[model samples]
Target: MKTAVSIPDRIFEAAEQYARRRGIPRSQVYAEALARFMAEQESDEELTEALNRVCAEVDTSLDEFGRAAARRVVLPASEW
Candidate 1:
């Protein structure tokens, strides 16, 4: 698929240099960058969903008690 979007001159120059050095098409470099970015976003979304599920399953009282205990045992950075 063909797409056109403008980028800063410096970033364009750098990406061109990167593509030339790696002996790959400029389109391939942009494609890989987008692919990696999308993958990271998906991974982060999945992790957040899993964490929310687990947190919802745990007892709120237990969680609050742990927080209270941590407050008692943990010292302020200034004190440390």
Candidate 2:
């Protein structure tokens, strides 16, 4: 697919230099960067979904003792 997008001059120059150094086409550099970015986004979405599922199943409420213990863990002696 052919698409034109606006990018900063500095970034375009850097990508051009990188492609030239690697003996690859400019399109390949953009394609690989886009593919890697999409993969990272997908992984982040998966991680968020997993965290949501875990949060939904787990009890978040703290009993009095649990709250006290958490406070102790979070607070310094001077603050306590």
Candidate 3:
């Protein structure tokens, strides 16, 4: 599919250089980049949905002792 989109000059120059170095068409570079980006976004959405489903199914909460342990583990990290 052919499409027109605006991009920064620096990005365009870098993509042109990359295509020349790899001996691939500019369109192929853009297409591959777009494909990878779309896959990453899809994976993120799937992970979020899975987490939500698990949280909904599991009716649980930390006891005071468990919460204290968690707080101990996290307090040191917050200082950094």
Candidate 4:
């Protein structure tokens, strides 16, 4: 696919230098960068979905003793 977009002159110069040094086209550099970015975004979504599923299956309620312990751990000053 062909597209056009704007970027900072400094970043363009750096990408140009990188492509020139590696003897690869500028398009490949941009394509690889976009691919890595998309992969990371997808991985983050997958991690969030997996965490939600695990949280849904576990017990989240606290008993009286557990609540007291949690309060002491959180506040540590007031009498229970």
Query: How accurate locally, in lDDT, is each candidate?
Result: 0.90, 0.95, 0.95, 0.94
How many angstroms is residue 65 displaced in model 4 relative to the true structure, after the best TM-score fit?
Answer: 7.0
RMSD of each: 4.0, 4.0, 3.0, 4.9
Which regions of candidate 3 deviate over 4 angstroms?
60-80
| TM-score of each model, paired residue for residue | 0.74, 0.79, 0.75, 0.74
What's each prediction's clash count?
0, 0, 0, 0
Q: Mark the regions of model 2 whose C-alpha exceeds 4 Å error after superposition.
A: 65-80
Clash pairs for candidate 3: none
Query: Which lDDT tens digits does candidate 2 get at residues 1-80?
Result: 99999999999999999999999999999999999999999999999999999989999888999989877876665553
lDDT-wise, the better of 2 and 4 is 2
RMSD of 4: 4.9
Could you give candidate 3's per-residue lDDT for residues 29-58 as a string of tens digits?
A: 999999999999999999999999999999
Tens digits of lDDT, candidate 1, 15-55: 99999999999999999999999999999999999999998
Best by TM-score: 2
